[model samples]
Target: MLNFSNNKLNNEGRLRTVLDIGCGVASFGAYLLSSDIIAMSLAPNDVHQNQIQFALERGIPAYVGVLGTKRLPYPSRSFELAHCSRCRIDWLQRDGILLLELDRLLRPGGYFAYSSPEAYAQDEEDLRIWKQMSDLVGRMCWRIAAKRNQTVIWQKPLTNDCYMEREPGVQPPLCRSDDDPDAVWGVSMQACITLYSDYDQGVKGSGLTSWPARLTSPPPRLADFGYSNEMFQKDTELWRRRVESYWDLLSPKIESDTLRNLMDMKANLGSFGAALRRKDVWVMNVVPEDGPNTLKVIYDRGLIGTVHNWCESFSTYPRTYDLLHAWTVFSDIEKKGCSGEDLLLEIDRILRPRGFVIIRDKQAVIDFVKRYLVALHWETVATADSSIESDHDGDDIVLIIQKKLWLTSGSLKDTE
Candidate 1:
């Protein structure tokens, strides 16, 4: 637990951001944010490396790479200061070149520092390594300004060299999971309800919390009564036709009619078949609702006592089918089979080992997470993905599950 108390540098910018050089289990970055950027350099030692869940929880961006790698990822003159925290001597020595990159990433007149606990320097070598860093910083126009028991602050002299031609921040682009099977797309199926429920959230990404005042009262959504899935099938084709009609509105400009025809077909499909993404935006947001009022007479009759959750809050349902578009509907049906054996198979395809998934039970569509999705696995945040319009009616079931993991490379012990 390192503490940051630099008033002089923190005072310069209206908002302050820092890069935690070797931030181990230490998320002080999320706790402190004056304004901008806070990321962890890509180091495998950090168990949570590439863990967007943690970063998203705190609104911080995560990235990969060792310091001083050829070009810095950020444009020159970006940060007011560069920070390194809880990194000791062994790691510091190997990352010596990284400090130069940090200095290079800093704004014209920025500061760099490293912090640790009171017992930060365990041995004489740790003190010697700090001296080595101090010397290097001095040669590069950085001068020591302040020092506490285990923290040292250094300032890089104001220079145009830092402003002229630095590359962008070494941050990776947003995770586009459709292309990568291993990486998560950050969207969920159950999460899509609230999105489409509204006329605007699907197209514009406005949250239900911000819906117009007049439309505050909730209404019948897709999952109120129970699971039929037939409705999803019908809506799929409807969305496809609508998208195809939309594409026809645009003039033809392609070289090949065959490709054009394919594009036309995909356009109707919606998610994968989506064309002109500008018109429709794919979305993901926190929490969801599977509405109960939208039920038909048959299943709605059985939904008497189960619609609500343990919390007993009628308004806190997790109802809403995100995207009712064709491609999403088809995929949901194709991939996620009904519970039991099919459920396990679908779960296998959708989740990685140790990866968790949120499932919506077809039986009782409750608004609160406590209703059903929790029994499967969703103890943490629920997950879903789709291209259909989402609704926030609070009727969707949240199924949380983690993929199973197994040990590999078992070996005999060396007892000799």
Candidate 2:
């Protein structure tokens, strides 16, 4: 069985909740409830009355309901975890309508554990189901925390993909409408039929609720670090358009026909990396250590980029990347309690000679960049106003710099 503690459901030092689907005998639910975890269990009314009674006797919430046919009686984003084992529910049926329901119930960064020790087989049928489950979750952007012989644990993404579904009437559709209920559950009747068919064919499984996984109130802002959670949270289309326009203008000025390697510093969920990816280039996303589970979210999306932490220097050797893009990294570093000098030196050390560094932030940040970086042997190439002004902050400035190279003793050296 999967361990909830290992998954760190209470990592933030708070109480957590879970749902136990197809909870046979209600033993698991009872145990979780006894352990101070709020556990809810769902089993069919006709078949599991005694088990439900046992769960209720133990103070575990128990209910009778058929998935697919009956909507789960819980508000969306209600659970920190959902678990199923040896039940007769087809999670992969109807292109994963059941899984989508779980997704709906799970808060962001929540977990789902499906256990079937006896179901493990090299048979084509079993393999087919496993592959389908993996692919479906992959598309849903759920992170596979573990894939043992009899179980698979997945963590829900921290944030929904921004451009997964583009604005309606905007050229080609980037993704199907995420908000459309039909897209998640499909035709309810057919889904029900499919669930029954799987159960009859011995390919079916099992159903639960929880507390909210977020803090009850906002934490204090980093007043000194030039960063605010509010700004990062307000990434509207207007902000995207401005960033896109900046990149479009910068692309032509870059000399490389096929920019080989790029790094995005403090790349929260990799929207910038996704935006900048091309046919030939490899983009790497580096996020802060406490970026609210950013690395896993990016990995789960299977975007065209590698994920790393900003606390460490780039693993690549000196002169490795063709370009480095850090839209708001300096400010993020300030907020994250890291030295800007360390980040800049690492960027310079990893970037190839004359490789570009691009950043965008407020004018105060731009001035700080000019002052600090010039002292560290960096050459300022260009600085321009992004013309995007915020009501509470100054107008954004786009600063571009290049690493300088001097040949000495048959090797490249950094020089003024």
Candidate 3:
């Protein structure tokens, strides 16, 4: 067994709290206590409560529950590290029921270690499990941090559904899957239910613990539930044209005097930037660092795009642009664990006074931006709804917003 004391994989040596499932007699918890680490162990002692008392006597906190049925009695994102040793239940299963609960329990960038002696077995049954496990990790949105002989470790993503591929040629990651060949949307009903159920239980974006209290409806199903490479390829041209036509329609209405510099958030293939080139606007685009390989084609077209991981804070100065164009950017960001409020705040910081924002996105995102705009006192100049919707996606709504320059005492004195 790898030493947990100084393992670099334990969140860069800052491992604090651990959840040890199927903790037989809580021996691991006792050891963790010796190392001054908080060990929250889970075990069953209904027939005989001796093991529970033993763990408590050792100064280790332990809980009683059937792992698969009962929800873990803890807040969301409560553990930094989770471990399971032959926990009876198949941890590598892609069913998404219990695993979704585990995902919710783990903090962003937290670690999960599952140890199985079967992984080292040469038997046919063990071999099949190992292969399925491999396939499961490949389909999951999480990343595999490391693997020992019988133990595999995973890290929870900072943002769910956001791809972070090291190589450019690989396909973008999928959020959820059912392994079903004939299901509509190619995803099983169970998988969709699990994903949304977890989301409702507070498996949400970075810095968020629960869903908005104002939301009365149940959480929606995973928006990109059954995404595939073929689907993306087919829709690429249609999406590109949608963006181009959106800007073409808005070009005449925009105030030419104020539209100088432009920033395109989530600039997939840089189509929106290319669309703005007809005007004299200096366009800069932002894309995820591990975005699709098609981005190379955009670069080949001589468009300006900067690679950025939107999961983290953006690197830019305030009030840097006069115009911002976003097509489905807010929805994508929201799906990947970024709140629209947070993104709009960043947009507000980087936009100049009286600058314009052109957003072509879904109704939810538009509502979020409008709420914040009203709170921030920004002005909305126009709104439009597209008659044509995405082939399989939601309808698009457009909003034109202008940044307001308010007169403060300091700035008023400067003008005087």
TM-score per candidate: 0.35, 0.40, 0.40
lDDT of 2: 0.56
| CA lDDT, every model vs. true structure | 0.34, 0.56, 0.58
Between candidates 2 and 3, name the one with more favorable lDDT. Answer: 3
Identify the runs in model 1 with alpha carbons over 4 angstroms from their true place. Answer: 1-9, 12-15, 34-52, 67-72, 88-95, 116-122, 160-416
TM-score comparison, 1 vs 2, better candidate = 2
How many angstroms is residue 297 displaced in model 1 relative to the true structure, after the best TM-score fit?
57
Q: Report the error of model 1 at residue 233, Å.
A: 46
Runs of candidate 2 with Cα error greater than 4 angstroms are 1-240, 256-258, 277-279, 304-309, 372-377, 388-394, 409-416
- Candidate 3: C-alpha RMSD after superposition: 19.7
Given candidate 1, what's the lDDT at residue 202?
35
| Local accuracy of candidate 2 as per-residue lDDT tens digits, 353-393 | 86788887777777877886656667777777755433223
Ranking by lDDT: 3, 2, 1
Give per-residue CA lDDT, model 3, range 159-268, as digits (tens).
Answer: 54444333343322233454321121112223221122244235443222121110111112212234353543454456556656555666765655546657777775
Candidate 2: deviation at residue 370, Å? 1.6
